[model samples]
Target: MTTTIEILNPTFARVSGQELRKAPFPRLEEGTKVRIGFLNNQKPNTQELLALVESGLREHYQVESRTFFKGDAAHPAPPEVIEELSRFADVAVLATAD
Candidate 1:
């Protein structure tokens, strides 16, 4: 008797040829206080991970952090949430910890 097995791939690839572009963020001056915005992906342990990062930043630099939940990890964040973060933070971090 012979047995057959099938393997499935659950990976995503970019099929388009268009290259991505992004503007470089400005450098911060020395002694400047930094405000970091955290976008939680609503995944397991994502909040804990962000908390640790926030703690580290606060210990080493003059940092302020604000966290916003994105409701669903599989969807994009709401425009209002992005706008609020943009107004309050100099840099943003979107974390996903499963």
Candidate 2:
């Protein structure tokens, strides 16, 4: 008697490495004020969580500015909001609080 087996994976889609684009990661230098941007998904406790993160960073680094943008919870951020954030923030932190 012969037996056959089937294998399966949980992933629904596979993305090619060539299709991915890499963004530059900016390095923070000591003694220089860093601009921080917060993108909030407007979920519960997102604002509070971002605030806590901001406070933690401030305790260790010199922050230049804190820019906050609220985006829709179910959709991607608007282009205008992204543009504004890019203009003001050197680095961005996106929050999806539960």
Candidate 3:
């Protein structure tokens, strides 16, 4: 009797090596009004941590910000949410809490 063994990959994969299709958005310009968006991954204490960081940032620079919390951390932020942030924010800070 002969037996054969089969191997399987029981794992997920990540996307990579994509080329940019468009130019990146410009950085915050010098001496210009700045609007920053803070995104929280809804992990424990992330909001508190971001708030502290925001406070520290404000101490050094005059800027505005809006805070957003993702519905779930395991998945990426919704496309609409990202679009809205792009329209409203000049820069974004994504927070991931371990």
Candidate 4:
């Protein structure tokens, strides 16, 4: 006997990646300290990866980080998580280790 399982995924109409080019990077004053929010995409080792990236950023920039959010395996960062991150961080690094 054999068994089969099905998985469903959300779909969106395809869009050109070029559309992203119009967005600009956020501006910060020289020497402005940056708070980085680290998001885990609910994957194994995500926290460790985020920590390493945070460490690297700290070595060169005025940086701090908080692991303030997590998401299920199939979803990206949640809106609430993003909102919270925006409140505390100038930039964010999302990590996934599947």
The candidate that achieves the highest lDDT relative to the unseen native structure: 1
Model 4 lDDT tens row, 1-98: 89988766568557776545543456766556888887777577777777888888777678777887665868667788888987997776755656
- The RMSD of every model to the true structure, in order and in angstroms, is 5.8, 3.3, 5.3, 9.0
> 1-98 in candidate 1: lDDT tens per residue?
99988766568576798778895564776556899999999787888888999888777668888999898998888989999998998888955645
Q: Candidate 1: misplaced stretches above 4 Å?
A: 1-19, 29-31, 95-98
The superposed Cα distance between candidate 1 and the true structure at residue 34, in angstroms, equals 0.5
Quote each prediction's TM-score.
0.70, 0.71, 0.67, 0.63
lDDT of 2 by residue, 1-98 (tens): 89988778667577765766787767777656888888888787888888888888887678766555565788778888888888988888855745
The alpha-carbon lDDT assigned to residue 41 of candidate 2 equals 85
* Deviation of model 1 at 20, angstroms: 2.9
Which rank order by lDDT, best down to worst?
Answer: 1, 3, 2, 4
Candidate 4 versus the native: TM-score? 0.63
Model 2 ranges off by over 4 Å:
1-17, 95-98
What is the lDDT for 73 in model 2?
83
Give the winner by TM-score.
2
What's the distance in Å from true for residue 10, model 3? Answer: 13
Which candidate order results from sorting by TM-score in descending order?
Answer: 2, 1, 3, 4
Q: Residues 1-98, candidate 3: write the lDDT tens digits.
A: 99989877578576687876974565654545678799889888888888898787676556798988678998888888888888888778865847
- How far in Å is the alpha carbon of 83 misplaced in model 4? 0.6
Clash list (residue pairs), candidate 2 = none
lDDT of 1 at 87: 96
**Candidate 4 displacement at residue 10 in angstroms:** 19
Reference-based lDDT, each prediction: 0.83, 0.76, 0.78, 0.73
